[model samples]
Target: MGGALVVYESMFGNTRAVAEAVATGMARVAPGDAVDVIEVGTAPALAAVDADLLVIGAPTHAFGLSRPTTRSDAAARTGTGVLSTTIGVREWLEHAGAPAALPADGATPARRGLPAAVFDTRVLRRNLPGHAADAIARRLRQLGLSLVTEPATFTVDGYTGPLLPGELDRARAWGEYLATLLRALPLLPEDAGATGARGRTETPGTGRSAPRTGRPASGTGPSAPGSPR
Candidate 1:
């Protein structure tokens, strides 16, 4: 088994809690695996030679991956300088030109073939049209990470949530499951045969599954345990 890391970004406490749960799950299922959970910006050294599987978490923002509004986050940074950075996070990315060019990394090739997964926290759309979790999943696939497609949806009765009661437990389960996979990295059971495949376990909000910061978009229902992303 290889050492694993669970990295995440959360605005409100909901996504952070989910991240922890996922980390916990990884530890439980793969006791032999080393698991380190870190928040987004404070992520461990991804460039480390010892690093193996790379796990990520984020909220679905405005129908997409919630980023700092930078021009380009994952793609901007070069091996050692700003010229090679993914600067599209908080700034207007359009100026860089959607059809424009991205910085080329002379030190490392694009992370086009890494293993990755995405999880999201969101408010119910009353329909599937606003399902941002799926969007997060899709983005991860585009980045060339092997898709585990374990995207999840968190319940938000209204904006700031009470989490509909059993949210924490559900979060814990997610963590345990992730630990299981990380422990057996590069060789765990495929999503085709287990927990997430055909309703083997009870999830937080929706079955098809589905964080945080500066008060995300508001929800319309009852109060949730935390805020909606």
Candidate 2:
């Protein structure tokens, strides 16, 4: 809860900008908190995410996560450097393993249920059927990560464009809210360096889901092949 890692995939830099803004917001609330912002291309798999809080963002491609074809189309259209088409948040989560460290009994560490949140950049005008953010959130939950917020979106002007006005500010605000939420929650015994993995079961209500408000780019964002599990 004192450390946060933000991983994002961006072709036009919109999503990366949002990720920085969110990190800035988190810093405002917890000045001493550790925060790492990583781009998907250079980012390690999700299992390697070693923070108490994990925040992920990507451009909403087709309707969900970006696939090989969409990523290629984006790089070609933008003429900007793109990461490997085979790798993104979706692919990272797909093969993510269990936590690096566990309790002596080999039980899932109480901290294994790390708090997580997801966001995406999308076109404001075109309404998409699915969301990369939602897909990422669901995958994190499947990995036993706690959901600190629902899928959130920041708006972009068009396919490859400037972010909508004030979206960065909103993202900062969201980060601050996430920090406050993390602070108010009690840490698990193991999380506090206790001798064993002992704590109450963390159910859904323990984490707060943020409300939906905006969209991102239309064609330039990530689109999952299907709905989130």
Model 2 bad stretches (over 4 Å): 83-86, 97-111, 187-229
What lDDT does the true structure give each of the candidates?
0.44, 0.65
Tens-digit lDDT string for candidate 2 (38-78): 88877765655667778889988998888878888888886
Best by TM-score: 2
Put down candidate 1 lDDT per residue, 1-229, tens digits, no spaces. Answer: 4566666655545566766776676667667777777765555333331334556665545555555542133223323322212311112212323221222231332233344445555554554344344554444443334444345556554433445556566666655544444444444433311123221123346432332111111211122122222
Query: Candidates' TM-scores?
Result: 0.57, 0.74
